[model samples]
Target chain A: MKLIPYLVYLLLIAMHEVIWRDVTAIHGVTINLAAFLVLAVALYKSELTVVWFGFFAGLILAAGMPDRLGWHALALSAVAFTAFHVRERINLKSPFAKFLLMLGGLFLHNVLVVLINQSGGFLYLVWHSALTGAVYTSILTLLFFAFKDGYVTVRKIRDIF
Target chain B: MTWISRLFSRHSRNLHLVAILLLSAVLIYGNNDLNRYVNRTTLFFSWPFSQVRCSIEELSGVNAENQRLQQSLVEASLRLTELDEIRRENRRLRSILEFEPEPGYSLLPARVVKVVGDKIPVSAVVINRGQEDSVLVNQTVINQEGLVGRISEVWPGGAEVQLLTHMANRVAVRVAESQEMGVVKYIASRGMILENFPIQGNIRQGDLILSSGLGGVYPARLVVGTVASVEKPEEEAFCKVLLTPAVSFSSLQEVFILRPD
Candidate 1:
């Protein structure tokens, strides 16, 4: 497959980690774009491609924190691998099914991140940051999935007009 | 061997996952130097963006800081104005403390309670001291500056002092330098004119006019005013001398009743 696009995706993930993570955060909640992108790749790309991309995305995401790099990379790879198998087993013909999968995946990833980074306040963070972040990211994922498919199209709009 | 190759291909993904896990375990438990390098590199790239972000945050806070500073400025200005008024009052009180009344007359400090007038702002002012304070009618009222007025009416608790600015008020005064005598009276048309003074008196502009003790109403040697101008008309018998009152009548706050010893 093409390597250049994957490199660009990794760069985008790094950009999001450093710049947009805090800027786009609402209150204390933030979007887990690295996990979301990894899950998206698992939905379409091959299992090997998904796992590798997830690993690199994790590295880029946790680049600011050097001590957590290896664990984050491993965790993202595991998430990609699991999501790939789940996609293989589940019938995700509709965008709704894909949206649900994305929501679940993002929530799991957010929980993992909180567990890795936080020294205390596990249950509180799970309720506040992890849950809200998952929901916030899921809404964006749903919109993305809807646009990616022809659920609402330009041609359909022209015909309606 | 062909069976072994198929097994290897099938389990390649699992082996890769295990490898990633081991690498991550190393990063998590050890490799501080590696982590520091990675974090430093990340910060190096993100520094410019973070600077911009900090500036934006500070800019947002500027409006709140500005409003807070403005409020503080207003409070400080009001406090300063109050302090200035207090300082002026303190200076007046200091001068009043140093003031000494004429010999054989004791000074009783009194605050001006109420001022009554139509044209001149304070033609008559009621003092807090009355019969209870031993303040009697015709008693001379003076302040730190000089002669203010004399007690006109006295009640059990309060007394009204007629200021020298009043149309009915008169003070027998003399030129301090020449000792030339004149009766100073207030007229609506011509302010405090020295009357009954000879046209040939050795008086010039800016001569000090003091109470001459002739009327038996006011004491002698008390400063009343300074000679503003002396006009000796050819038709008039006496010189028409104008005087600038030494006491600032409009700002009268404190006064002393000159009671005999």
Candidate 2:
């Protein structure tokens, strides 16, 4: 319930959007850091916190494009609400289950973004851009899950070295 | 903290959802200035890191360009050396503009393809012209400056000249001022000395020595060298005269064979 941590998370989202987005992109496919963070908050935080954070994160993502501000905020909030409910209904005791939740949430957010921007036909973008981006984000989600589940550790890596 | 817990309670969830929806609707239909202000605030917070990323990329590009410039510098240096050689050849050719052979003989231009001796101011040379070009043995060879030597042995496509630096090579000469005749010969240690001139011959340094036409091989009045020093040694019969050869044999490039008309 501390307000300062959420503020710090929002700052991280803004930093990723402004500085790391282009640098981390792979052959024109970019990581959806904003959606991933929103889904993460939905997984662990209260419903109200996730929803507001999702809205603010979308605003940060669309900072350069003012015309799509409202649509992006609405789309991201909808994804966060759905992810929060899915987490509640589904048994997420397993890291794989939480990873599935993150992947599904990110894919949903990407599709809505493509739809809101009218980037192209839904089926065409679904495989090429949206699904590829979701997969890219999901890899990061799996790494985060591994760290949280203690499957990987810095000490273990050093021991190998 | 109590109010925060109450806000996350099940009942307040619906109110928070409605509040998020209303905020979205207001922003979507609201004036453009509101959205722009929010965007501006976000970008202002991220501006410093964006500048740092740009600087890093520019530094990498400069590193690649530095490698390219090093390659270009090496290429330019080789080109400059080639151009300097050509410039020296150009100056040599310009001085050859006034060159003419003797009245009754025609000059055949030939390049010195190789020198045949180990000594500096080489003792012999091979010219590009040979028997195929009407070149034969014992033909006098001269450059625009003065005498070089004579063709010694001829091949089909080339001929070698016995240069005046050869110890056996001799020229019958006379001082231009006194017309006092002498014989010029090469000595490895003493170098191009006038061996057979009279002790009292009117010869001195700066006097021009020319071929006297006494030896049937070389023509009359063809300059061989200049008297560089004159010493009437008490023990010697002839004046001990040292001459600086007109043609620098070491740097010989082009010459003319005096083929009889």
Q: What local lDDT does model 2 show for residue B110? A: 95
lDDT string, candidate 2, B118-233, tens digits: 78758998999998999989999999889888989999999999999988798998899999899998898888888789887788899999999898889988889998998998
Model 1 C-alpha lDDT per residue in residues B198-244, reported as the tens digit of each score: 98888999999999999899999999999999898999788888989
Worst ten in a row by lDDT for model 1 chain A: A10-19
Clashing pairs in 2: none
* Number of the top lDDT candidate: 2
Q: Candidate 2: which docking quality band?
A: medium
Off by over 4 Å in 2: A3-11, A116-124, B1-11, B57-84, B114-119, B166-168, B186-191
> Which candidate should be chosen as best, given DockQ against the real structure?
2
TM-score of chain B of each: 0.77, 0.85
DockQ of candidate 1 compared with the true complex: 0.43
lDDT tens digits, residue span A1-161, model 2: 88888777777877787778888999768899999999988988888888998888888777777778888988999999899999998887788789899889989998988887887788888887788999999999999878887889999889999
Per-residue lDDT of A9-91 in model 1, one digit per residue for the tens? 77677667767888899997888888989999999999889988888788777777787887788778888988998899888
